[model samples]
Target: MYRDNLYRMEVPSTMPAHAFAPRNLNWNVEQGEAQDLAHGLEKSEAQALVFVSHARPDDERTKALFGFLRRASEVADVMIEKKQQSSWDAIIEALTPTLPLTSSRVLEAKMLAQAMTKVIESEDFARAADIAEIGHFSSKNPSSQPNRWKNSGLIFAIPYKGVDLYPLYALELQNGAKPLPIMEKILGVLQEKDDWQKAFWFASPNSYLKSKAPKDLLKSKPQDVLRAAETEAAGVQHG
Candidate 1:
C-alpha cells in the first residue's frame, strides 16, 4: 500500500509539459511583442514584419521541395481570406484604380506554390520522404474566382517520389515533354471532329506518346496541356 501511494505521488511529476494551457504560454510570450507593435503605431515608427517561423534552421531537402511552397501558400491564403471577409464597401474603398488584377492573382498563386516547394524540400525539414501534403488544387474547367483566389490546395498522401514522380515523369517522357497537347492533327481537324475529341484523354497513356515536339509545348504545366490535342481538335472541327 505504501509503494502504491508513492507511485501515485510520482505520476504527476512525469506529466508532459503540454498538459498546461497553450494559450497561457502564448499570451505570456506574445504580450511584449503586441505592446511593442502598438507603441510603434503610435510613434509612426518604421517597421518591417520579421517573419518569425516554426520551421527549423537546419531543414534542407524538405525546404527546397516544400518550404517556399507551403509558406507562400499559407501567406497568400491569409490575404485571400481577409479579402473575402471584407465588406463590399470596404473592398470598394480599398480597390486601386490601376489594379492589374489578373497579374496580381497569378503572382499570389506562384508565391504560394514556391513557398510550399521550399517547405517540402528544405534540409531542416528532415522528414523529407515522410512529408505529406495537407491540401491541394486542380484546375479542370477552373472558375475565375477559384483559380485566382485559389480553392483548397492538393493534399498528398505520401512524399512525392516513387508513386507521384514516376507517373509524372513517365507522362513527361511519353508526351515528349510537348506537354499533353499534340496539335498536329488538330490545328484544323480538331475543329471539325467534336465527337472525336471525346476519344482523347490526357490521363490515357496512349494519348501522350510522341517525339519531335517542342520542348516548351511538351512540358507546359500539367493542369494545362493535359488535353491540348483533344481541345484544339474540337476547336478546329467545331469551328
Candidate 2:
C-alpha cells in the first residue's frame, strides 16, 4: 500500500499499482494493460466514494499551506503599501464601471470621499481632546485653547466628522506646548487658503523642500520649510 503524502493516509491496498508510478514512467507503459490493471485492482465504487468522502487533510500539511499563504499575503501587503497611489488608482480603475458623464462624476465624488477619510484618520492629526491632552491644557474647556491657537493663525485645523482635527506635529511640546513659531509665517504665506486647503498644503510634499511634506520638516528644517511655503505662495500669486 502506498501512502498519499497530500492527505497522509494509505491509499487502500486495492488501488492500482500504476497510480503510484511516476508520471513519466506511467506515460511510457501500455495504455491497454494499465486499463486492465485498473479494472482488475480498483476498489468498489462505493468504497472509493467512501474513501474520498472520509479523507481529511493532515495537520502538518494544513499548517504548512497556511504558513505559505500567510507569507504570500504579507508580501502582497508590503508591495501595496509601497505603491499606495498606484495601487489605489488600479483598484479604482478596476471597480469603476463604464458610465456616462453623471456616473463618472459620482465616481469622482467617491474618490474624493476616500481621500478625505484617509487624511482625517491619519495618525499625524488628532482631535481637539487628544491635542489638549498632548498640549497639557488642564482646563475645563480643553478644546478652547486649541481653538484660540487656530483663530490666531498660529496653527490651522481640518474640520472632519463634526470636529476640528489639528496637526499634532505643529505643536512644540518642549516649549510649554506653544504652536510652532514657523506656523504663523507659513499660514501668512497661505492666508488666502481656507483651513482645509492649508491643512492639505502642510501635508503635501513640496518640490522646493526636496519633496518632504511641510509638516514633517517643521521642527528639523524650519527655514527650508518656510522657503518651500513661500515658493508655493509665489507660484500661486503669479499663476
State how far residue 128 of model 1 sits from its true place (Å).
23
lDDT computed for candidate 2: 0.67
Q: Please, what are the lDDT tens digits per residue for candidate 2 over residues 1-239?
A: 32322211112324345332222211111112223334433553322211111123344554565456445544553564457667667888999997666888989889878767767766878877877776778668888988999999998888876888888888888745778889888888889888877777887878888888888899999988888888888888999
Segments in model 1 whose C-alpha atoms lie over 4 Å from true places = 1-146, 149-200, 211-232, 235-239
Candidate closest to the true structure, highest TM-score: 2
RMSD of each: 23.7, 18.2
Model 2 — TM-score against the truth? Answer: 0.54
Error of 1 at 35 (Å): 74
Ten-residue segment with the worst summed lDDT in candidate 2? Answer: 24-33
Worst 10 residues of 1 by lDDT: 1-10
| Candidate 2 lDDT for residue 181 | 87
